[model samples]
Target chain A: MELLNRAISGTMESSDIMVEIIPWDKDLEINLKSDVKEQYGKQIIALVKAILDENGVKKACINLKDKGALDFVISARVKTALYRAARRSQ
Target chain B: MFDNFSKKYIYSQNTRGRKTTSDFLKTLGLSFDENVNITINILDGKRIIATASAEKNLIKCIGVDENYRSKGLMNTLISEIISHQYDNNIYDLSIITKIENEKVIQSLGFETICETENIILMENNKNKFKKYLENISKNKVANEQSSAIVMNLNPITKGHMYLIEKASKESEQVYIFIVSEDKSKVPFETRVKLAKESTKFLKNVKIIEGGDYIISSKTFPTYFSKNVDEWINNYCNLDLKLFGKYIAKELNIRKRYVGKEPYCELTSFYNKKMKEILPLYNIQVTEIERLEKNQKAISASLVRKLAEEGNISQIKELVPEATYKYYISKED
Candidate 1:
């Protein structure tokens, strides 16, 4: 219930993050070897912008390896990964 | 409106202005008389990105669901919201949250102080919160003479002159403090000199340097970062503790004069705190509504930006000829 109990205070650093999402639903699977179109990257980036914009992260470079997870799952994974990455940077 | 650290990115992202559909869902809602109105959208297109709202002063709420996570949507939305509030004079803003939400908020320059069980009161500065309401009640009516005017004259300009003139007419003495800092384009001393010269006809006014304690941008960078409320409580609380006695002694000033900052959230908090604290010192707080030209509050920043673009003509209209010439010649 308590998603954040620790101090989120510290300096921010940059690095490449390859996020892998595993969906609870099996139907979400897609081509793993398909070349990701530039547009898809842009779409994912838009989603990321929404998250960061809502959250207020200015200095960060995130890399994602999507496994076609559901919306809630993707959000949790990204938030967890971002928190982890942020902790590592600190 | 980005009254937190993430405001910088919003400023950067604003330049790109991408396109998409879900972006329409980024409706920042405002409720008035129980009517809900959707404000600006944060996305470029179809994606429902992050969203933020500041109808609530102490805390502006921002929400970004999962699909929008990781791309800085929340940051952008919050930044934009904060920027909007700052532009509208809503300083001394804050965001309410539980302990777990610390990282996301702190990185954006929010300072956390314990407010209640499990609720961390993250604010920017505290000194600015000492509202002088008690003093106002005690004083009953505002005295026309001996009012104290405080300002962050980042650069004193003609519009500022108009404010000083207005105060001089109403008060017997106006104590003006020019903010001093190394990053200032025009040194504090020079600003004080210019301000003094421009208001030379007013014998009752006096100008002094705002001590490092009050004006250091390092102490409170929210003005530029758009994170004024993030640290305003801490700044105000600390300052009130530090300057409480000093302020009581120096001017014996019963009324503190401040210019209306329509765009900064912290200023509103300041007005609130001044009203709260002045009663302790038996002082009162007065706000001078801005004298505007072209519907814009004449400000030092506008002057500096205009001067940078060689737009001294308009600058002259807001400032005295001597001050206008000073800025123009400095450009040369």
Candidate 2:
């Protein structure tokens, strides 16, 4: 789905991730910040990419500030933000 | 210890929590921070434990109870503030914190833009500074003997023109960085336009927007508003150090220029502080006497007053042609 406007979901509280989506013209860009960068950064990025692909989202800038959120929480936030941001059908 | 806490997002529209938050901030050696449009407080069932706030793009008044250290509350506080700003579509946010409180803010993914002994300015967006350097460095000539001036230009005046002309005559290149903060009756865009149009004829003079680096005289960080007089010097030194450390080096600026203030003691003190500090960075400081008419220095504030009160021809002698045209057209 294509994004209509900028939408954001989630919070920066502990064990939660703040996800922000901006409509982009180029390739998909995911900026992830996590304290566990060495151990789980790749896994987190892969999960987000898969979620975006599952929802057919392309050309969106996703900003994630992860405070050690589990995989499921990350996926939920991304999908919710994407769904809210998606362009409507004619 | 962190088990029984609830967080509340308080803003101006619903100020139910402002008084408590203000008192809470006071106990932690920080003020309630006047003019903060958004604030978030972590409450221990009515007693405040931690809090943070933002006034537009700048964040201040972050405090967590001393007993609550190492429980991840600071991170939550900062992240909440970022999320608040993000919700407002403010992606580029920054905080001016004392050097002692540096680590907590840095841990929340803000990189230091510039740091001095007492003050450190940090920002969340990493790309802003990089792009600023790229844009300003485009005008960098081969010579390192370049000079720079950061001006507020409330409205470009003849005094400003004379100062820029002096720098143009002496320096290999002159960069005019128009201050970006919008606190004046004259909006930032109009000020920048006036500065540009007035200096269009100076051959080697280039105009650049000051962005987040150049601190304006209007924005004395509310972080240090508690000690008003003392922090003024600190703020001025902070700006000069930013020039000497990054901007001057990037543009090969070796000398800095200023218009001597015959009025406004605060600005006079700023000139005094610049002379004292810029020398330590090995950047020469030149103070040009104000351009005068009728034996009085032409002041930007007086012109703004005259323009607003329908005194167009009176200020004609004070401002340049570009600025005079702007005010005259507005009169009609």
Candidate 3:
């Protein structure tokens, strides 16, 4: 399903990632603002890209404001944001 | 002790290497806003001792190392930001800080405008904003039924013209504030010129600059943020609240005119928020249906697309004569 509107999930608090998804014309632009960018940035991006590819989100802008969130937290936040963007709970 | 301290502008790519600036912001419990345009960092031989950032007209995230506090580094940082803003033709500067740091900012000639329990909003040029309002009020011939429209006429189309004309006819005086942020494909100078020429026939309309207070990157950074939903609600609330509480009162504006947003979700959300919030301040929100052609809404984005494709014939139908002429001249 196409992303209908802009949506966000999670918060800026510790151990969580605030994921925001917005519609885009072409390509997926992933911007990550993380506290641990030097150590875990690449891993986080890979996880998010895998999730987007799985969900068939081809053209969208995804922004992750991460505060030391683990892979599981990142996955949950991205899933929630995508669901919210598509206007579906699941 | 301060001999090694050197001030420099922080570019986006260089931010990672500037650990001192990042550490300073982190210590103050402030996240480094990636949208920061002008940043002044005082480094003591690669150690960031003091730092301040100005997004547009609002200065924020100012922090100094505890070791350098009593030596007046904060004052220097604030002064530098002020000078930077002034150099950019931004006269109305504001800073939002915790109540504890209020006195420090106040010492640098900023006066408190509004205060909540946790934060205080101070401005360096409250008098300038007030004076601007007074000038508008004094010059307005029909102040009895005044209205306002804050718009970014990126490339003024017939839709913008329609809204402005409607507002001009309905109110005794209409203040058309062109958004001054230069983040558009069409430069601010060109947009302002096109808007002025397009609405020259409307006698009751007075065109002015929005002046960093309305829909600015400082208050509403959604325009730049790819994640439009993240901070839009909070920023829009703060922006509209500032308008309702201060700007509306100062200019005696009782009504605001906006175009109906049917395409962009962010704009639609902004309109909804305006309708819900403006009434409390007694400023009525009037959202006019957008002009359409061929069953499609006429928008600046459409005009831009047509221009990019070199479709002048179709572009002529969507834009006003002034915009058409401007585009034609640019083609030459």
Candidate 4:
């Protein structure tokens, strides 16, 4: 799916990660900032990559500000942001 | 998330907004900044708990309710502000945050550009300052004496041309940084075009668009919690410190040239302050006498005054061909 305008989802609240997706020309670049980066950084990045790959998103710059969110919550926010990016501005 | 947490975008036109914002900031030991364009308050029903305000692209006056600390509220606060700015097509944003809150802001994707004893300057995109220097690095010439001159050039005049011409003769290479702020009678684009057209003949000169790093008195806030004189001193010194530390080092500008101001007290004071401050970073300030016509110093302000009177002949004598043609066309 082609990402349209820059879309943002979720909040900075605890147990939630704010996801910002902007169209990039080159490739999918995920910039993650998480409190649990030392422990779950790889897993969180891998999950974001898998989700973008599944959606056939070829190019994007996804910025994630994580405050110890669970995997399900992270996936939901990224999916929502990607979904919003696909739609025209409302 | 905190219960009943609702954010309000305070418009500049709202009158009661001032009292409420000041009351909220007073609790945090900070005061309301009057220069804010858009201010957002995270309210708990009737009371303001957290707030942040932006003056154009520079975010200042950030205060969160003390009781709300360490609760991930900043994430919501900053992301909202960042997204708000994105909607306006302003991606590169800066914040003049207090020195204490540096780490927290850095965690929220703001890279520190430079920090003083009190304030830390940060931006959203990292390595942008580096990139600004690198873009100009292409013009960097190997020279024993490379000098820099910063000018507003509201309208390029013979005085400005004479200064650059003299600097070009003395130094191996010269850089003319056209001030980028928009507080001038003449627009930035026209000034730049005139500066280029007048000096296109000088082989040793390069004209650069002074970006945000070049802080002008008008664009910066005067809310440094110091007296007027102290704040002005600190402001000019800090601006020179940035130039000396970053720009001079990157471009090998060992000399900074300023035309002696016989009129504006502020310009003369800046020249004096530059002499005192820039040397600490190993850059020398050289003051030159302004070019004279009819035994009076030729100046942009003088040209502007003549233009106001529609004095074509007098304006023609003080300005270059490029500026004279522009003035004639503009007066038309």
Which has the greatest TM-score? 2
Clashing pairs in 4: none
Q: Per-residue CA lDDT of candidate 4, range A1-90, in tens?
A: 888788888877678888889897987788988889999999999999999999999899998889888999999999988888898432
Task: Output the chain A TM-score of model 2.
Answer: 0.91
The TM-scores, chain A only, for the candidates as listed are 0.46, 0.91, 0.97, 0.94
Look at candidate 3 and tell me the lDDT of residue B129: 60
Q: Candidate 2 overall Cα lDDT vs. reference?
A: 0.82
Taking the tens digit of each residue's C-alpha lDDT, what string does model 1 give over B1-332?
Answer: 12232221222234222122113223322111111112334543433355454443444334555565676554445445544554454534566554677876664445664343334556533334334223222332234445666666656766677778887887777777566554566776777778878778888777765653343223343321233354465555444433444443455566677777787666667667666766566677777788788888887788888878988786778777667768778878
Top lDDT hit: 4
| Model 2: pairs clashing at backbone N, Cα or C within 3 Å | A1-A56
TM-score of 1: 0.43
Point out where model 1 deviates above 4 Å.
A1-90, B1-145, B216-230
Off by over 4 Å in 2: A4-7, A21-32, A57-63, A87-90, B1-24, B32-35, B44-49, B65-71, B141-144, B225-230
lDDT of 3 at B27: 71
CA lDDT of each prediction against the hidden true structure: 0.51, 0.82, 0.77, 0.83
Estimate, for each residue in B1-332, the C-alpha lDDT of model 4 and write its tens digit. 56688888887888698779977787676777787777888888888888888776788778888888886677777877877776776666788766788988877778888876666789977767889878767778876669999988889998898999999999889999888977688999999999999999999999999988888554556544435465566667667778889888878999999999898766677788899989998988899998899899988888888888889888887889999999878866
Q: How far is candidate 3 from the true structure (C-alpha RMSD, Å)?
A: 22.0
CAPRI-style docking class of model 1 based on DockQ: incorrect
- Please give each candidate's TM-score: 0.43, 0.86, 0.63, 0.85
lDDT of 4: 0.83
DockQ of 3: 0.01
